[model samples]
Target: MEEIKLNEVEPYVWEINKEGDMLVPGRVYGDKDIIQHLLDDVKQGKEWNALKQIKNVACLPGIQKASLAMSDVHPGYGFCIGGVGAFDVNEGVISVAGVGFDVNCGVRTMSTPFTKDEILKVQEQLADSLYNTVPAGVGSTGDIRLDKDEIDEVLLRGAKFSMERGYGTKGDLDFIEENGFISGADPEAVSDVAKRRQFKQIGTLGAGNHYLEVQYVDKVYDEAAAKAYGLSEGQVLVSIHCGSRALGHQIGTDYLKTLEAASKKYNIPIRERELVCAPFSSEEGQKYFSAVNAGINCAFANRQAIAHLARKAFTSVLGGSGDDIKTFYEIGHNNAKLEKHDVNGELKKLIVHRKGSTRAFGPGRDEVPEQYRAVGQPVLVGGTMGTHSFILHGTEKGMRDTFGSAIHGAGRAMSRKGALSCCRGNDVLRELRDKGILVRGHSIKGIAEEAPKAYKPVEEVVDVMHNTGIAKKVVSVLPLISIKG
Candidate 1:
């Protein structure tokens, strides 16, 4: 790989000039140390060569202005993890690779009336209860079984289906992106195999990087924003991170094969087979998009069901009504959406694919929930197992600069293999316990794979976002107990 010329645009922003078929420049947001680390990764031939992925993304059809890579940028299927690219709807194509297999795999956080003092008393019991009530582990099935008709309703209604069935409150929907449901989902576009896979897994937390964490507010940065989010020091919070599970993986696998065979029919040149795509307006493309929307809804429903189970666990331990636990916000990082953006002084609707990136729409954007319209969309950034997570609000600068997108997580510094080589699962668990954190997992190997040393320091990543004006910090949280599936 040729040396990537990184121009320091600001304290936290770097730019790579357009080259080798790239239609626009590639931009990255990170501090000097991160940039150097990225360079080292490139030198070592790890696929996180974000510079190349950014350029590859710029070369995609109808990409406007620039291809933006967040500080968390790492190797992914087509786009890098933490990659953000927007293409003109009338002129662009949609690639299944841009949206990974876990369509709408995202995170949601909830605030609880309980405090650290109260939670500590039953921490172990809470962890055990949650693990039992919420189905987890590889290929785990739950009690919520859905037939074909019910599955269609779930795809159409998303979290609303669960809420109506007494899973959660209407307030939860108001705080979710698109009210937890993206319209235009066509269940008919979903394959029978995918449907069957989702039948028994509607409420389960699938394995691999998926988890449910019980945390407490560790610090407050922006007092006003923290107050608006109903967060205060020592307050308890629950975060659920998972995705569409088998249904989504099957959808991506099924459609990618179709797109691969049909790419020749559309005369779309293949720069990378993994980047296979179809014209946005084409029949195959539309069908795939519809199915992807259904997958997104599936995730919303999945999380809602998990939230219901989580509430039950909390009540069993805390002895209170479920009202004590209320949703803060839910956001999706995987998948693409049809959005209107200003491109070269002209506003055009486009299909924006944000893989491992969160939508950080600034204040006044209609998409922001009504209660939070003044403060901008909330951005949830999860750290490593024993690190600090942050709540950030979108900034006006972010909206003008990067199509209202921001970093999603700490991003892996080392692969799972590297992490396992460094430490054993039992040792990692003991260390976490020593640090005052309780952990429960379906497998010990899973715990070892996500060791804190495997990820970049989330604090540094958040600082880059703050310095770059992409998103401003609201508060910081530390984990008290975490459950991994």
Candidate 2:
């Protein structure tokens, strides 16, 4: 690992000074405990870690401000898991590691016009309904079967296509980020193999860290913001966490070779294989970026279809119309979006790459939905199956410092191999059941892989974000039932 020195710029903030081949400094947001963990990893001789990745990203062409990481910083493919980097459109490069293989992998939490008490009445039945209704596990296939031509439509239209196909409602668009469709997506940019992978996988919940959890608001931190989001104590909600399924992964795989070749062609020095990228204005760069947007759209469509399936399952067991469950807010953590931001005194367009980091736009941003403009965009911070999740609001400080990014979840404390080595899958299931929580997983080993002990304490993680004014807490939710893939 590279020896990186951190100088405290402020409480909960650290900076790595510009050094050899570095174009910008590296900035990390974390408290003492988090920083110590990173230091510990370095001391243990881990070659690939967040600090090193942060430094590597700073060396990339056209990187702006700083190579940033939120509180949940952890070693990832090229960028740190909670990494955020904004680049000049003309001079910047697009890295597959920044967008991640999952593409728009995110969380969509829908608030139901019901309470925990109501959910408890049919808890077991509801769990069964969800586990059976939604497809899960590796290579999970959904009921939807789209032809090649229609697959292109899903790439272009996103959730709107799902709605037109009788999944979800039109009202869902406003609550979704980018109105559920990202512009500049070219279906033709995506390969036939990627499209074929999505033929029957549109609505499936694929394995690994993806799940649908039924949660209830346990506490409210901001009354005004909670009210605006239609959340109150004991309110039941469903949060779907997944991404572009197979299509996203296929795109990432297909583009890796192209970008690697482009990296050499354009003379862009590569610090890591996953960091191979082309200048954003270059031919190969445009193709990969366009394909990535298509993957984002594919993810939006997947979540929309799954959310509607969730509605049906909820109504079947709990007795209500689909309208009873409304899309509270849908946002992705893995994305590369082109937007205008303040660069010094001038407004400049930059492509912001956020991996395992949510877009947390603060109040007064025109991009935020009108209803949430005064408060800020809702940031859904997911927790573990046995722990708590959070709904936070973007902060002005966050936008100014972090390119409007925040942690996605309690950063993983243990790898799946580590978790499986010590924990038993059935034991994990039994423990959750003993805690009065219901869990349905297609693979028991997957359950053990996500054992609660495998993650950092989410409460501790959120406190850092709130204390730093990166993102403020609005509500805390506890899971009643979870469906893991």
Candidate 3:
């Protein structure tokens, strides 16, 4: 890999001038230290050298303005993780690698009236109850089995299906992106294999970096925004990190092969084979879009069911009534969406691919929930198991600058294998316990790979987002008890 010179555009922005087949400049948001660390990773060749990937992403057809990378940028399959690129709908192409296999893989946060002291008292019992109630580990399944008709409902109604089944209330939908459902999802576009896999996994939390954590608001940066989010210092909350599960993975794998073959048929030239894509108006593109929408719906439902299970654990441990806890916000990352944006001077519809990036729609955006319209959409940034998480609100500057996108999380500093080699799972659990965080998981090795040291400092990432005016910090949270898949 060649070292590209990065010019400092501002205190929080860096740019790489266009070169080779690159159609636009590459922009990254981060501090000097984070930039240097990413540069070192390129030198070591242990992970995706993100800088080159960012440049490669610029080569995609019909990309508008620039190929933007967030502070958490890391090398992914084709587009770098944390990459945000928008392309003209009429002229652009949709690539499977850009959207990722885990479509709508995201985080959801719920705040409760309980206090930190109240939670710590029953932390161990709550963790064990959650671990038992929520099916996890590789290829985990749950009690809820959906038939063909029911599967179609899940793909269309998302969290609404769970609400109708008495898992959640109507008000909960108001806080989720797209009311926890993506319209225009055609279940017929989903293959039988994908449907079969999702049949029994609706309420389960699958393995590998997915978790349900019991956290407390440690500090408030913006008091008004924190209060609007129903959070106060020492207040207990639950954060669920999950994705579309097997259904989404199957769709990506199945369609990418088709798209690759179609790319050859269409005679589209590309530097990388993983960047397989079809024109937006093509039949293949429409089919993949439908499958992607279905996957997004699956993720929304997955998080809702997991939240229901978490509520059960809370009620079992705290003896809470139905109205004691409520969902604060549910948002997704790692997906693509059709959005309207100004290109040069004309407002045009574009397909925005946010891989490992979160949509940070600014104030007045119609897509934002009415309750949060004044404050902007809430952006949940989860850290590693034993570190601080942050709540941020989208800013108008983000809309004007980066297609209304922001960093998703503290990007991985090392691969899971590398992190596990450096830290033992038992030691990590002990350390977390020492810090007053009760931890429970099915596998000890899972804990080792997700150790706090394995990821970049979330504080730094939030700082960059704040400094860059993409998102502003609302509050900071710390875990009291956590359950890992």
Q: Return the top candidate by lDDT.
A: 2
lDDT of each: 0.87, 0.92, 0.87
Expressed as tens digits, the lDDT of each residue in 437-473 for candidate 1 is 8888889999999998888899998898998889999
Q: Give per-residue CA lDDT, model 2, range 1-485, as digits (tens).
A: 45668888988889999999899999988888899898888888897789989999999999998999888899999899999999999999988889988999999999898889888889999999999999989967999999999999999999999999999975899999999999889988889999998899999999989999999999999999998878899999999999999899999889888999999999988888898888999999999999999999999999999999999998888786889799999999999999887877678899999999999999999888889989998999999999999999998988888878898999899989999998999999899989878999988899999999999999888888898899999999999999999
TM-score of 2: 0.98
* Distance from true location, Cα of 14 in model 1, Å: 1.4
TM-score of each: 0.97, 0.98, 0.97
Worst 10 residues of 2 by lDDT: 1-10
- Highest-TM-score candidate: 2
Give the per-residue Cα lDDT of candidate 1 at 309.
Answer: 89
Pairs that collide in candidate 3 are none
